[model samples]
Target: MDTATLQHRFQTLLEQHRKIVFKVANTYCRHGEDRRDVSQEICAQLWKAFPDYDEQRAFSTWMYRIALNVAISFVRSNIQRERHAIELDESIDIAIDDSTRVHETDENVRALQAFIEQQDPLHRALLLLYLEERSYRNIAEILGISETNVATKINRLKQRIREHIA
Candidate 1:
């Protein structure tokens, strides 16, 4: 395909699946600015990898893989990023997008978010994909784990969340 055509296709597909980026970013980053930075990085990586994306697979799945990988790497690469979370003088606009977020004021949601925040990065990524309702096979493909491992980890994570929220 021509460069122009590829660019248009990439733009359209990225726009359609944009929420995957935000969901991953919000799941991984504690701060709004960090989310924004991670979101941009995810987009950049997606674009860089776009040319190689197999058209046979679902774009959302491909986008999720790229976005999650970028977000995990961003968090893992920066230790000091935690201490430097710039306190927003205003509300976090990025965190409150029209995604599947539960109400911020709900105690249960807050507890769940706290639980999510405390998990290590890999578990956080796994929970993010699981919460997206991706099938075990898809989760395995994205995270490069076996389907059985995905199921086992998810069941264990589910139990942990139950204990956490109980």
Candidate 2:
């Protein structure tokens, strides 16, 4: 494809799947500036890979793989630098789209997010994708795991949340 065509396609796909960027950033970063930096880095990496993206595949699937990979690497590097300490600013509310999120005041949802955030990074990514209503196959594809593994991990995460809330 020509440069113009590729640019148009990339723009459309990025706009459509932008939430994946935000979700990954939110799951990985604790502060606003850090989340913005992560989100920017994810976008940059996505653009770098755009030429190699196969048009026949689902855009969100491809975007998730890129975004998650970037977020995971960014988080790992930050963890090493910070000596594995994470600071949560509960007062700074992270906005979730109305379609995916319950009322911010809902205690159950708040507790669930808190629990998910506190889990291991991989499990946190799994829970984020699960809560986003991604299918088993999609989650597996995004995480490079088997469908059965995705199911098992999701079930375990759900049970962990329940145990914590109870």
lDDT of each: 0.80, 0.81
Model 2, 53-110: lDDT tens per residue? Answer: 8878888988988888888887777776662355545565656784554454667767
Q: Report the lDDT tens digits of candidate 1 across residue range 62-105.
A: 88888888987887788565543423222333344465444556
Off by over 4 Å in 2: 81-84, 99-105
Candidate 1 residue 45 C-alpha distance from true site, Å: 0.8
Q: Candidate 1, which ten residues in sequence have the lowest lDDT sum?
A: 85-94
Query: Model 2: how large is the Cα RMSD against the reference?
Result: 2.2
What TM-score does each of the candidates earn? 0.87, 0.89
What's the distance in Å from true for residue 139, model 1? 1.0
lDDT, candidate 2, equals: 0.81
